[model samples]
Target: MNKINELSYNIKIRNTLYFEAAIGLSGNSFLLLFQVFKFIRGQRPRLTDPPIILLALIHLLMLLVMSLVASDIFMPGKRWSDSTCKFVMFLYRFFRSLSLCATSLLSILQAITLSPRNSCLAKFKHKSPYHMLGCLLFLSIFYSSISSPLIKYIAAIPNLTSPGFIYITQSCCLVPISYSVWNTFYTLFTLRDVIFVGLMAISSAYMVTFLYRHKKQSQFLHSTNRSLKSSPEHRATQSILCLMSFFVVMYTLDSVISYLRNPSNDPIFYFIVILVGHSYASVSPFLVLSTEKHVIHILKCYGRTVDI
Candidate 1:
């Protein structure tokens, strides 16, 4: 009786929490898509920092797909075929690594974009956008391929839960991956996350510090005029901070929680952690839309048309 109650509780946690989070993720991801379209299709269709929002929307779509796979995996007696399991695991790892790399790219690009004259990144400021796009594509596809081996962790199990429902319960969950491989995964991925997080932190700090100093230097030019000057760059810095807060900080927590979870011992925290992992996709778009005036203008235009 106690075991059944516990299992039921775990199932409820998986379903309810995941459903709620999924709803938010699905809605916000579509909102981002709509906003992006509005900006691109509006009268003056010049996107500001196109790469950042583009990558974010891609990450959001991937998150929505991953959430659905997670829903399947959490089913108590469900069993997956070898190929099905492999694909799901592969996509999950691939998308996550892609998100991390995209975020790091956003930070580094912003750093280069905002660097002052004679700064170290100034030389690369005029780097070809075509080359940058190629590199990002390679990173998202080729670099992320390294996680393909993780599919070995997934295995199929029989439906021993209920004799009556044997026909319906078709798939199984991942057995605890081997301790050595699992630990190695944790160590290696943790190092990867740390490296990217550090890069983003340093880049964001440099941008914000440069902008603040630039504002202060304005005061020196005219001693009697002490007001801080506002610039588009200042707004860019704020947007970058908002984007980083969502991607870097929330991502670190999600990664740590995912690494430490013991699915057999506790399924609740796993669901909760997974929820946090996807929330970045759902919430980050609001930041992007709010920070970019053009997108809001388009939204307002659309709203007015609707009102009429």
Candidate 2:
């Protein structure tokens, strides 16, 4: 009886954590969706171009579905049907795969953007942005389709024999060693991408520093003259810095939590990992929208105009 009670307690805790994380992610999705709409309406620059916008939209939809699943798990006497649970689990796997593909595409785009004129990627700069978007879409779709078959293996069965496993209705994960190996490889590849992101962040910081130094030197050189006007590059650099900061902070938190978690048996660690992962999606839209001056200006203008 005591062991059964402990199992129930752990399940409750895990479900609560999942629900909270889902709520947080859902909120983030809404914010990002609004920002995307505003960008489409010309209120803000499309920071995420067409390919990224499509990826974000897909991610938003997945989060909404996950939020529903999490809620069902948390609410008493409202557990999802076996088929529904299996479907949600499949969606989760699919979305995770898609997220990874999208992130890789984003990294490639950034690499191209930063490439020198003499480099191979330079040829892409002259190509239309739509062409790049098409290429990214193709890559993501190909990878996702290749991974889709893994979802069919997932099944939900009643747990009548196990004490600690009763809460798990769907068995939707890859075989343990295989999954771990794949995860390790994926993490290695993502580490390379993370290094690239870190490089971007460092370069952005350097650019900001250079800009400040230039402004300071100009002020000293032309004392009593008018202050230097900010150039468009300066503004773009600032915006990029804001974006970089958000990525660094959130990714750092995720890395730290991931390192601390032992994925095999510790439900608490798993809960924390999920929470940290979902928190990033929730905060991402606000980071992009609120940090941009034009978006803030548009919001202010809209507020005043509506008050009139």
Candidate 3:
């Protein structure tokens, strides 16, 4: 009975992962293809469009890699070889880092776009694409240089029933490292997360301030008018703010759960952590697309054509 229950639980987890991956892949793919079509058609892209494209692509790849990892983690019987485990995990980590950097850049880009002409951030408006590219390059280098230890430490579990192996997944485990080494890597990873999250928070605050000042100014100018609709830039900023807020919440929850987890190697705990960690990648495209009028317009046109 116990064995049967465990099998059922694993099956449920696997199904949940499959569902999440499918939804994320479809959303991200649609967003990506739409943006690509815009570029191909020589349409003028918004300042935030490039980052959105990059972000969609990043999340798409991350979800794909995550789906692969989930297959190894939940499927029983055949185990991933050592090389397969290392490669898949390394890809996941690489894309994960890119996601963080891209999100931070997205928020900052939105803030720059919404800045008043005389504001300090206005100067960055024209140079945002270059800056974003440079930042992503730097971040990729940083991840390769600082987080490369993960490649060394991650290995396929030689024996599933071994007593000394640390549980990462059913097939992969982290080999033991010295306390000093572990502390060094832990601190570096934590610091990286802190820096990106801090950037996001700062950018979000700036956007909020701009929106508040704009609202007050508009109110004073058009006294007693209650129907002043927000501008496109304002709507975009709000969307990015919402996305950043959700990302921070998910990040904090995942971090806290990881920090507080016991060594009992609970499968449920692992699934929760994974779900929290992947939530942003799986959900962000919809958050972004919700504010994109272009996608809606295109869909409407397509529907009309279909009905004809």
Candidate 4:
């Protein structure tokens, strides 16, 4: 009885954390999409513009879908039927696969951006923006295709034997890790991706620091000249660096929590993991919008106009 009670408490904590994370991520994604849309409309839409924007939009949608699933599966007195639960479970798996693909592409882009001019990826940098756009699209499609098959095992079914908990109502149906080898492979793959992401983050930070120093030196040298200012590349680099930094920080925390979790069962840990994961998507948009000087200026101007 004590063990059961402890489990119940853990499960409740886990669900609450997951719900909060989902809500936060959803909010961030929404804000990112809005900022992207506004930027595209207000400025010229480039070849590289669509995929990240689309990804953000898709992620936002998935967050909403997941929220509905969570409510139906986890919330008491509002549980979904088997069929509905199953559908939501499938959708969550499908979207999660796509999200991973999208994130992978984003990481690759960051790596390419930082690669040396002599590197193979440098060739892509010189390609027309349209070509870069095509590359991103192609890469996204290939990654998504590779991951699609993995979603089939996911299901949303009630835990008839254990009546009280929510996550049990519907959970991802992963293929049984029948062998230690498979588990090892899975761990390696996850580690590889994390390493790649870490490299990208490091490169981004290096570039930002380099740019900052360069800017300072240039300003000092040209102190007397009023005409010389930071270039567009500097501005764009700053923005991208800021975005990457935010993603890296949030994702690192999420990954750490997930890594610490026991796969067998630990609801409180699961809840915290979910909360962190979801919070990123929702908060990202606001971060982008708030950080952009032009957007802030526009908002201030609008306020003044309204006052007038």
Best by TM-score: 3
**Candidate 1 backbone clash number:** 6
lDDT minimum window of 10 residues, candidate 1: 161-170
Sort by lDDT, best first.
Answer: 3, 1, 4, 2
16, model 2: CA deviation in Å? Answer: 8.3
Query: What are the runs in model 4 whose C-alpha is more than 4 Å off?
Result: 1-42, 46-48, 76-90, 93-133, 141-153, 156-176, 181-185, 195-199, 202-206, 224-232, 263-267, 302-308
Off by over 4 Å in 3: 128-131, 160-162, 223-230, 297-308
Q: Model 2, which residues run further than 4 Å from truth? A: 1-48, 76-86, 100-122, 139-153, 161-237, 252-270, 299-308
Give the per-residue lDDT digits (tens) of candidate 1, residues 77-136: 445676776676667677777777777777778777778788887787776644566666
What value does the lDDT take at residue 88 in candidate 2? 81
The TM-score ranking, best first, is 3, 1, 4, 2
List, residue by residue over 156-231, the lDDT tens digit for candidate 3: 8886456655777778888877889889888998888888889899999998987778789878887532432436
lDDT of 4 by residue, 128-174 (tens): 44455565566546544543444443344335433323233334333
Query: What pairs collide in candidate 1?
Result: 78-171, 78-172, 79-171, 79-172, 80-171, 80-172
TM-score of each model, paired residue for residue = 0.76, 0.60, 0.90, 0.67
lDDT of 1 at 91: 70
Candidate 2 weakest ten by summed lDDT: 168-177
Winner by lDDT between candidate 2 and candidate 1: 1
